[model samples]
Target chain A: MIEVKDLHFAYGSNPHDTLRGLTFHIDDGEVFGFLGPSGAGKSTTQKILIGILNRYRGTVSVNGLNLQNLNSDFYESIGVAFETPNLYTKFTALENLEFFAQFYGSGTRDPMQLLTAVGLEEDAHTRVRNFSKGMKVRLNFCRSLLNNPKLIFLDEPTAGLDPVNLRKLEALILKEKSRGSTICITTHDMHVADTLCDRVAFIVDGEIRLIDSPRELKLQHGERFLDLEYRDGTSLICTSISMDKLGTNEIFQKILYKYHIETIHSREASLEDVFVKTTGRSLQ
Target chain B: MRLLAALKQDILFQFRHGFYYVYAVLTVLYIITLRLLPETLVYPTLTIILFTDICTLGFTFIGAIVLLERGQNLTESLFVTPLRLHEYLLAKILSFLLLSFASAFFVMLGASVGGHDRMWFVYGAIFSALIYTLFGLVFAARARHVNDYFVKSLGIGLAISLPILAYLRLFDTPLFYVFPTRATLILLDVLDHDYALSEKLFSVASLFIWFLVLSGWVYQRFDKYVRHPA
Candidate 1:
């Protein structure tokens, strides 16, 4: 659905390019993520694809149209929910959606229905200024789905939501995935990247350090050790045994046979561990 | 249809923010101030009031709206949709033009019966509003906040309103003729007096050139400072 190659962008005042050379592709219906710390040019890359930042040195094509030549019609199939809620505070929630929905032709989701989907149907008539941050975030998310967009760009989509709403939002995103909508999310949140993205790109300093599926990366980076807890007389003994050649190792066999095992489990690296290890920087 | 919807929403937004109420009180103040003037002075005073109302004040008004929209980050969100920049600008222009027209009409009703060409006054109000709104749009497109808009607009406002010094005969210069504000005053003057065809054409032609120039400047600046601020 999207292709970017050798993307380089620099602010006018700054001679150094903020985005040095970014190359990536997002398949149709696939959830892709740009995992990076703040000021890592994640939003800048998204803006270029959305055609907001046009002064960039590279090829960025979205839905077969080059970002350089996209007309207003090109936005018909694309939706973006900015990190900050960009909404009219004076307008009611329903009014805000209806106002935006007018920009699209047909096939827009009903404003009230979208409100209900985000658990905000009751506050549809309330001014956005009265809404909580989570409510505004949900409303912003709902706006992204207004056109049943083929490609959706969500920046920090779950920033302000509580666990319940966060899960609900995750479910809604998965629903979008199920319906074959390609999603691009830029966030430092490892959990969001792991659960939502089909393929994740570790981007830092306007470059991609790595790109792969979360499960694959975890296995590649994990220690693959078998953690065992057993009772040795009155004391409990804990040990990590390598999974390599486990069946042939006499020590692994003896631990299971000689000692009363309290627990035995494999230790796997999480995406967070992999991210930190690969990037050599904290997500913070 | 989208333009109309945007126009309606702009007006609705301003109204909800009490702009209409502010206009109500401001329009009344204008009518009352005009009514107190002597009959001989009413037209000249109305011309001055309408000039300020439609031109200078419209400049400030447009600045306020754009600054508010920017503050709310609506400008960025707006461009993400299928709305063209020209359509968005047109909606803003039309909304403020209509407000200026309505306010002028009420002020005329409360102050004068007939001594002027009604349609000319309407045209004057709209044209002046368009010219000055575009003038303000240039500044607004670059302003970062409400105070930023107000401060920057003050200097540009004074610079553009310089033609008034020549109109009032305090400082007469042929250079003032180069300004669209000179053409704006001509349009307003046309409402109260019969002008030669050549004068009317010059007024119209000057405003046309200024409109095109200011509109282009505004579009470029808005595209730069607002759309691609990143």
Candidate 2:
């Protein structure tokens, strides 16, 4: 649904380029997560895709239409939830949604339905100034979906959410995917990407270090070794073995034939581990 | 059509604040205060005083509204939407004008029954208030902070009104007549059924010119400041 080719962007007339010929694509109904720490150009890339920060030196097309030639109608086909909760505090949650809903000339969703989906139906009449950060984020999330956008740009949608609410929001993103919406999410939370994304891209310093399925990347970078643990009398005995030749090895045969094995497992790498190893930086 | 919906929502949202109540109370207080003033102190009709109050207060209201929107970052939010910048700006101006006119009209209605001409006061108040509001929007757009608008507008108001007020109280001069206050005074005279015909015509022309010039400035500045989403 979205394609970016050799995308490069720089702020103003500055000599330094923020994006250095980066390229990526997101297929239809795919949840693609751009994982990176802060100041790693995660937001700058999202801003370019959403058409906020202009003056780019690349080609970006959303839903088969070139971004350079698209107008406000392009906004009609997409939803955007900015990292910051930029809303009108003077208006009620419902009023904020309804006001923005009017900006689209066609296919506007019902504001009440959106509120209900985000679990804000009960507080629809209360002014947004009285809302908490999480509540405002939910409202902002609902606002993005008001146009029934085919593609959604979510920048740290789960940042201010608690675990329970985070799960609820994650489920909502999954629901949107089930309804055939392509999502481009940028977040530093590895768990979210691991659990929700169809594919994840690790970005560092405005460049894509790696992009692949979570399971595949983990398996590829993982150590091919096994650890066995068994209780021997009053003391616990641990042993390590190479998985490269485990079947024909006498030690592995002895452990299976002579010892009472309590647990045996291969050393598996996690998404966070692979992210750190590839980027040489932590997700913090 | 979509722009109109956004505008209607903005107007409704603005009216739901406590500040609207404060504006209503101030209008009532101004009417009662005018009634208490002795005859010698009251040069023009009470309706003219009420109209002038609207013109003064409208400037402050628009400045405050724009500053509030800027402070909350709602202006940038609107910019990202499909709503045109001109439509959003016009909606704000229209809402301010309508709200101020309603308050001024209620006061003038009561005052007109006593001695003032209703039509002249309504027209003059609406005209001058709109001109002052357009002037306020220019400053609001340029102001970096909300409090800065308060200080700058107060400075501008004083710089424009202080000399005119001093001259009117001290000595009459042809130069003083060129000021907005002097033109407003002529407007009041016309509203109170006492101005010469030529002065009344000149007041209308001068007030219209002020409205035109300030409105022109708003359009020019608005175009330069607003960057629509790509």
Candidate 3:
């Protein structure tokens, strides 16, 4: 769905390129994540892909068309939800959707239906200026779906939302994925990345440090042992057992038969841990 | 059809932003002031009003509107859709031009001004507003906020008025024909009844040429800002 080769971009006043020789591709109908901290070029990469920022030196093709050569019709097939949740503040929620809905060709989703999907049906007539931050974020998501887009770009999609609303948005995104839509998200939220992304690229300082499925990353970076906690007398005993050939090991059999096991958990690293270990930088 | 929707949205946005309300009050105040003036004073005063206030209002108003959009990060949102850069520019110019022309018309009608000369207010408003609105786009491109835009726009604001010196003939502007204000002055000088035919032809031609040339410049500048913001 998208491809980038040696993409480099620098603001006019800046002396250094914000994106420096990065390369990656997202497959069709895949949920891809661009994971990075602030100023790590994730947003810049998304902007370049969406044709919002065109002065980059690179070969970027989206849906088989060069990013630099993309016409407005290219946008007709894609949707973008900005990190800042931009809407016409003076216009009501319904008005905002109706206004943007007109920009697309036929096959666009109904504005009211989209609002209802985000649980915003009651506030459809409320001016955006009166919305809380979470409401605005939901409305921003609604606008992205107005085009019934085949490829979607979402930046910080779950920011400023309570767990219920956040889950609602994530479900909506998954539903879009079920419809065979390509999804690319740039975010610092690890759970969203771990659960929603089929693959993730960990970027730092304008470079991709690692790219892999979250599960693979965790296993590759995690310790190859099990954390065994058992009861001995009235006290808890903790011990580590190697993951390899544990069933035939005598100590494991002795611990399994002699002591009551309280808990036995494999020492698998979390996605955040793998990110920090691989990238040498925190997601903060 | 898309462009028309955008135009309507822009007009509605502008109206909701209190632009129409502000102009309504200004129009009423100017009308009352023009009616109280002597007949000899009406046209000359109207000429100055069209040249300075109504025609140049786009230069002032567009800055605020664009700055506000940038504040909300709405420019980024708008550009990501199917709207082309030129379409956005045209919508902005046409929307504010409508406001400028309407305000000029109502003020003239309320003032009881008539004759073919009064139609110059309509033409002058259009030509002058287009020129200033493009200037507003150029200035707003790099501005961080409304206050920052005002601070940066003052220089060009004063620069465009340079032709007023030549208009009064206090100093000869050998390059007056090149100035946008030069065309604006010639168009707005309907009250003088002394503008030569060549000058009238020059004003219309200069405005048309300026619109074409300045449009390309503004499009590239705005495109640059959107692509790699300063």
Candidate 4:
């Protein structure tokens, strides 16, 4: 649904580029996670794609239309949730959604349904200033879905949310994907990407270091050994054995046949490990 | 439709923030003070009150709104919507213009019984408000904080209003006519007596010219600032 090539952007007269020749693509109905630390150009790339920052030097195409050629009509197809919840503090949660919903021409979703989906239906009439940070974040998320946009851009959508709300939000995002909406999320949270993304890209210093599915990245970087845990004479013991010819190996067979086994698990790398290895930098 | 929605939102926001109530109270106080003044001083007092209400208050209100939006990061979200720069700007100008006109009308009624021309007063209020609002946008666009906005706005406000003092014979020079507020001051002068038709026409024409020039500059500056801000 979105394609970018050779995108370069710099603020004002600053000689340094914030984003330098970055290229990536997001397919329709696919959840793509852009993983990066702070000041690593993640938000800059999102802003450029959403048409908020217009002075970039590159070719960006959204839904088969070049970014430069698209006008206000382009906004009708995409929705953006900024990192900070940009809401009217004095207005009610429902009022904020209703106000923004008027900007779209047609195919707008019901604000009440969106609020309910984010578990904010009870606080729909509450002023945003009186809302908690989690409530405001949920309202912010609700605003992006008000138009049922074809493409949704979420910047750190799960930040500052409790586990229950996080799970609820993640479920809503997956629901949107099921409805065939392309999603682009920029966050430094590896667990979110591991759970939700079909593809994840690790970016640092305005450049993409790696791009692949989370499962594939883990498998490719994982060890080919299984760790066996068994109890020997009232003491717990752990041992590692290669997968190759493990069934015929005498020690493995003896452990299974003779010892009281406690637990056994394969040794595999995690997405966070692969991210750190590839970028030579921590997600935090 | 979009502009109307934006205007409604702006007006609602202002009301919710108590901006309208504060201005209403101030207007009532000005009217009461005008009632206590000597009969000979009513015209001058009304003229000064209207000028400050339309020109200075209009400018400061726009600046405050812009700064508040920036602080809340609302403009960044608004930028991504279908709302155009001109539409946003026009909504602001129209909403504030309504307040400035209402305030000026009350002050006029309190000072003059029913002898003055109301149309000229409305025209002058609108023109001056538009000019100052545009100037406010320019200043607020460059200001990073509310404190910065206030300091810069005060300096610019004084510079713009200094010529009005000159037009009031405080400085007494024809060079004061070069300022746009001088045109507004001349229009207000009609409250005293029937001014020459040629001078009235020239003043009205000059105000329009200033509006056009300032509007063009404001549009360009706003478009650039939103798309690629400093």
Q: Per-residue alpha-carbon lDDT of model 2 for A1-284, expressed as tens digits? A: 78999988887667888887889999999999999999888988988887666578889987788877766656767888888887888789988998898888777889998888878899999999999999999998998888888889898999888888888899999999999999999999988898889999899888898899988888898888899997766667898899987899998898788778899988879999999999999989
Give the CAPRI rating of model 3.
Answer: medium
Q: Alpha-carbon interface RMSD of model 1?
A: 1.1
Q: Please list the Cα RMSD from the true structure of every candidate, rounded to 1 decimal place.
A: 2.0, 4.1, 2.2, 1.7
Residue A199: error of model 2 in Å? 4.0
Identify the leading candidate in terms of DockQ.
1
Give the local distance difference test score of model 1: 0.88
Estimate the overall C-alpha local distance difference test score of candidate 2. 0.77
What's the CA error at residue B14 for candidate 2, in Å? 2.2
The model with the greater DockQ, 3 or 4, is: 4
In terms of lDDT, model 3 sits at 0.87
**Residues B17-130, model 4: lDDT tens digits:** 877997899889898988899887877777777788888888888888888878878888887777778888898888888878777777767555445675675677778878
Q: What lDDT tens digits, residue by residue, belong to model 4 across residues A1-284?
A: 78999999998898999988989899999999999899999998998888877888989988788887767878887888999999999999999999999888877889999999999999999999999988988998988887888899999999999999999999999999999999999999988999899999888999989899999999899998989899999899999988889889888999999999888987779998998899899888
lDDT of 1 by residue, A1-284 (tens): 79999999998779989999999999999999999999889999988988999999989998778888888988788889999999999999999999999999767998898899999999999999999999999999999999989999999999999999999999999999999999999999998999999999998888888999999998998888999999989999999999999998798899888999999988778998988898897788
- Angstrom error at residue A201, model 4: 1.4
What DockQ does model 2 achieve? 0.37
Q: Model 1: chain B TM-score vs. truth?
A: 0.93
lDDT per residue (tens digit) for residues A1-284 in model 3: 79899999887668898989999999999999999899899998998888888888989998789987888888898999989999999999999999888888767888999999999999999999999999999999999989989999999999999999999999999999999999999999899999899999998999888889999988988998989999989999999999899889898899999999999999989999998888889999
Model 2 stretches with alpha carbons more than 4 Å out: A1-23, A55-61, A64-70, A90-92, A110-113, A201-213, A227-234, A237-268, B39-56, B113-123, B142-144, B151-154, B157-189, B193-230
